[model samples]
Target chain A: MRAAIRSEWTKLWTTRTVWWALLGAFVLMAAAAGQNAIYVENGDVTTASVAVMSVTIAQLAFVALAMLVMTGEYSAGTIRATLSWIPSRGRLLSAKIAVVSAVTLVTGVAVGLLGGVIASAIVDDSGSIAGDAFKIGIYLVLLGALATGLGAALRGPVVTLVVLLMTIVVIPPLLQLPDIAVLNGIADAFPGVAGGHFLYGDADPYPPLVGLLILAGWAALAVAAGWQVLTRRDA
Target chain B: MSITLEKLTKRYGPTLAVDGLDLAVRPGRVTGFLGPNGAGKSTTMRMVLGLDRPTSGRALVGGRAYDSYKWPLREMGALLEAKAVHPGRTGRNHLLAMARSNAVPDRRVDEVLAVVGLTDVARRRSGTHSLGMGQRLGIAGALLADPPVLMLDEPVNGLDPDGVRWIRGLLRDLAAEGRTVFVSSHLLSEMQMTADHLVVIGHGKLLADAPMTEIMGGHATLEDAYYELTGSAA
Candidate 1:
């Protein structure tokens, strides 16, 4: 497993995708934070919502990074070579999960905290910087893992992005419509909604812990299904 | 390590790609695994490397299954296709990642790149290379582990004449070093030059497994013998 992690780490860094994605995430976070600072100036939103908006946009980069984690291998045919070298499918997958999650988590947390600081500097934010920022960071990492799983199962980046974007960005918001109000409960369980509430902290649908668990559950389900397809099918 | 397949079978839904075929590849010689297109050669190789699962039976390298090893590459090296590389990564980085997975040293990546004469272009992205360069990169990765068993599938597909000669000599030399070199090719004459033994399959079933010389003794040439055995020229 140590070897697997080492290999995954090397592969991730050696490829330019990870670096570009990280830059994209940071840039998005900075832009969103700047935009949110404007809202704070006009008292249109609180400092906490600023962190939420920043992460909501910035997390896309992490999701894309995760998508490329497996989709790149599939496209390049490197997964076959990788599996041939490691052979232990479960161990190989575990290492991928660990490395991607760890890297994304650390970076996400730093970006989240920075966004919080930007928001707080404009408005009178209490000490929500540490907690709100940290929680949002965790949500970003979990969302990345979910994207990784979706990438693996779908085996194509465009399709994974399309489906994931529709579910996370489009479907949940559409479900909140007054005409489709019946599905509001189901929509709340979606990653975008659950993660939003989890980051917001005071949302009433579910407790903060429950919200995180709900988001984690979505990640776990995606990765578990991906693992099944990865092991069963020929790479 | 010798490789053995016991009733190895693979089915893609309705198609029985490999139908309970069994064969043993010995060490210290280049064993040519030849078959017509779609005859399950690549599939069998994939199963041997545990990249593909068998429908029934098993493929074992040495005494255990392919995936049973903690570091499979340290036990065996394989080149299934030259197209299995990311376009954005340099050749050296690609091999380094594989080496890390199998606990092979980073220096080995440089060594294999040199061996395959890709030292000059090691820093270049694989996507920019021609097909021949890609083949050399694939061979470099295969040799990164320097394992006992080597399985190369159609490695000569995109090589020039000089490249072909280099690989033919390389295979013989690796075999002379007492390694089990299992090579697959469509070039019958090339196989005749490099392989001491032959394992031919047609439609995923073994048609001939014998010394290369013995198969040719009863025919005009290795190509004629292959055609006779596989019925492509018959």
Candidate 2:
């Protein structure tokens, strides 16, 4: 397991995708945070809110990064070589999840805190930088796990990205637009809504801990589905 | 190490890619796997490497399945296809990752690169490499772990004369060192020069499996013998 993790770490960093994706995430976070600072100036939002909102956009880049970790092997035909080396499908997936989660968590915290500081300075607003940064880190880690699982199950970057974007970015808002109670409840249960609830500390429908658990449940389900396909299907 | 196939079979939907193949490839010789296109050579090798599960029976390396080994690369190295690498990664990095997977020494990556004469381009992204260079990279990857068994599918596909000659010598030397070398190709004449044993299949069924001299009996050349065997099987 340790060897597999080291291999995955090497594989992830050896390519240019990880670096470019992290840079893209940071840039998007800075831009969104700057824009959100304008709302804080008008007393419409808090610095913590700006940080969370900025991460909501920047996390997409991390999603792409995580998905590519799996999809790239399929597209490049390196999966054959990889399986020959590791052989255990479960071990490979676990190693990938570990590496992706670690990288995203560390970088996500950095990006969130940096963006929060910049926004706070711009608006001269006092906010809990550490708390918001921790929240952003956890959210991105779980989201990264979800994307990695989808990538394994889908095995195509474009298809995985489309599915993730639709579910996380597109469908959740549309589901919330209707005033129906069932629809609202379904929307709240979605990973995107759950993530927002957890990050923003919304406690009406569910506590932040429950929100975190909901998102973690989604991640676990996705990873399980991916593992099922990976083990049963031929490379 | 020896590769043992016990009634190994594979079927894709309605198409039978490989049928009930029982053969033993021993060490200390280059065993050429020959067949026309779609004759199941790649499928059979994939099964042995655990890339594709056998529909029935078993394909084992040594006495166990390929995946049963903790470090399969260290047990059996293979070059299934050329350029089976990420385009954005350098060749050295690709080999390094493979080495790390099986806990092979990091220095082995540079050593194999040097062995395959790819030391200069090792740092370049594999996508920019020419066909011949890509083949060399794949061979370097297969040799990274210095395994006892080696399987190569159409290894000479995109090599120039020099590269081809280099590979022939390399295979001979590896086999001379008592490694089981299984190479697949449609070119009978090339195999005639390199292989001591030949395993021929057509339409997913074994047509011939014998020593080179025995299979070449009363034939003008290996190509003529191959045509006669595969032609009748077809």
Candidate 3:
């Protein structure tokens, strides 16, 4: 298992895709934090909320990178080569999920901290953001794992990215319709909306534990579905 | 030490890719898997390597299923498609990852690269390589573990004449080392030069499995026998 993880780590570094995605994430986070800081200066939002929102926007980069981890092998036709070495499909899937999750966890924490510091500096607010930043970081780790699983199930980049963007950027806003109270309530159940409660404390309907379970459940279900496809189908 | 397929069948929806084919590829000789286009050669090879799941039946390597091997590459080496690699990665990294997976040594990776005459460009990305060079790199990867069974598909597809001769000699030498070499090719003339035994199939079913000489009885060459058997040659 260590060897499999090592192999996956090497693969991630050798390809330029992951590094580029990380850089993209950092840039986007810095920009979003700076932009949101200006909005806070106009008393548009609280310092903590601005910090959390910036990190959430930046998590998209980590999600894209994680999705590429699995899709890269498929697009390059290297999955067959990978499966050739490790005949056990489940082991390969676990190794990939492990590596992507570990890397995203580290990157998420760093970006969350940096984004918060930038927001504080820009707005001249002396607010400490460790609590909100930590929650955002955890959200990123789960989101990255979910993307990895989705990438495996949907091998094409266009389809996987589209599906992910719809879930993240499109569906959450659609569920925010003012007329449908029931629909708005269910919005908290989506991985995207549910995870936001962690950063905002009591701002959401569900408690932190419930939010965490819902987000983790999304990742687990995606991975289980991907595992079934990988084990049952030919590479 | 051999690859055995027992009633191996693979169906992709309505298309029967491999239909209940049976054969044994033992060590100490070169056995060529020959067929026309869409003759299930690649599908069969994929099944043997466990890349594709057979709808029914199974393939065994050295009398055991492939997943049962503690080190699969140490038991069977496959060169299915030369382009079945991450193009952005260098040849060295490509082999390094596979080596790490099976605990094969770095020294072995270097040795195989040298053996395949790819040591000079080992650091270059595989996507930059020509088709023939990429094919050689794939062969280098297949030789990384020095496994007992060797499986290659169209081993000489993009090679120049000299490279083709080099591969023929290499195949023979590997067989002489008592490794089971199962190579797939649609070109009859090429198979005649490299294979000691033949397994011919068409439309997902086996047509012949016999020693090359026995199958070539009363024919000018193995190509003539292949034409009679597969009915492709005029």
Candidate 4:
């Protein structure tokens, strides 16, 4: 397992994708945070909501990173060589998941906190930076893991991108519609909605911990599906 | 270490890629696995390496299964297919990553790179490598572990005369050192020069497994024997 982690870390770090994705996540998250800082001048949104908005946009970078984690192997035909090294397919996939999750968590937390700080500074409103930023960072990591796991399961960049984007961007609005309260309640369990409540100080249907768990649960399902296909199907 | 596949079978929907394939790869010799396209050679090798699960039977390495080994790389070094490399990385970095996985030393990286005559191009991004250069890099990666067994698929697929001569010598030297070298190729001439033993399959079944000389004995040539074996199936 140590060897596996080292190998994956080397692979991830050596490639330019990791840095590019990190930059993309930071820019998107900072932009979102910057937009929310404007909300403070307009007095239309609470400080907490603006703080959360920054993390929300930042989480998209995690999604992008996650999508590339597994699908990149397929795109390059490197997965065959990878499996040849570690024949225990399950162990190999688990190691990749662990590495992807750990890296995403660390990066997401650091980037999320950085974006939140800059946005809050711009608005002159330091709402729960010390207390909530940590929680918000953890939330972004979970959301990133969920996207990574799903992207591996789907095995295509475009398909995983569409699915993740739809789940994150479209589901929330659909839930807002009338007569869809039940669906809305379920959508709250989605990684996007759950992450939203964690970052922003909103009236969450569930606690931040629960939201994180919900996202984790989605990631677990995605990983399990991916593992099954990975082990059973030809690479 | 030796690799053995016993009645190993794999079926993809209605197509049977490998059918009850049975073979043993011994130590101290280079064994060439030959077959036509879609003859299940790759599938069988995948099962032997434990990359693909056989629908029936088993693939064992040195008596136990592949996953049973404490460290599989310590037993065998494999480059199962051509160009199975991460394009985004340099040739050196790609091998370094694999070495890290198997706990191989950093110095071995440069040694293998030099062994395959890729030291000059080691720092270049692998995506830009020509097919022949890619093959050499793949060979370098396999040699990194210095394992007892080596399985390479089409190792000489896209090589110039000099590159081919280098690999042929390398394979013979590795086998001469008592390591088991199992290579797969469609070209009889390539195998004729390198392999001491031959394992031929046709239409997902073993056609012949014998010493190269014995398999070629009384036959016009190795190519003639290969054509005779696969002709009916084709």
Off by over 4 Å in 3: A47-49
Interface RMSD of each: 1.0, 0.7, 0.9, 1.2
Q: Write the per-residue lDDT of candidate 3 for residues A25-66, one digit (tens) a residue.
A: 889899998899998988887655566778667877898899
Clash count for each candidate, listed in order shown: 0, 0, 0, 0
Give Cα distance to truth, residue A8, candidate 3, Å. Answer: 0.8
Q: Which of the two, 1 or 4, has more TM-score?
A: 1
Place model 4 in a CAPRI quality band: medium
Stretches of candidate 4 above 4 Å error? A201-204, B232-234
In the range A151-215, model 2's lDDT, one tens digit per residue, is 88999889999999998999888888876888989999999889999998987699988999999
TM-score of 4: 0.95
**lDDT per residue (tens digit) for residues B1-234 in model 3:** 999999999998899989999899989999999888899999998888888889999889999988777679999889988998788899999999899888888789899998989899989988898899888988988899989899999989899998899999999999999999999986778889899999999999999999999999999988889889988776
RMSD of each: 1.7, 1.3, 1.3, 1.9
Tens-place lDDT per residue, model 1, A88-154, is: 7678778888999899889988888888777777666534677766777788878988998888889
The parts of candidate 2 lying over 4 Å away from their true place are A46-48, B232-234
Q: What is the Cα-based lDDT of residue B228 in candidate 2?
A: 91
- Strongest candidate by TM-score: 2
Give Cα-based local distance difference scores for all models: 0.87, 0.91, 0.87, 0.80
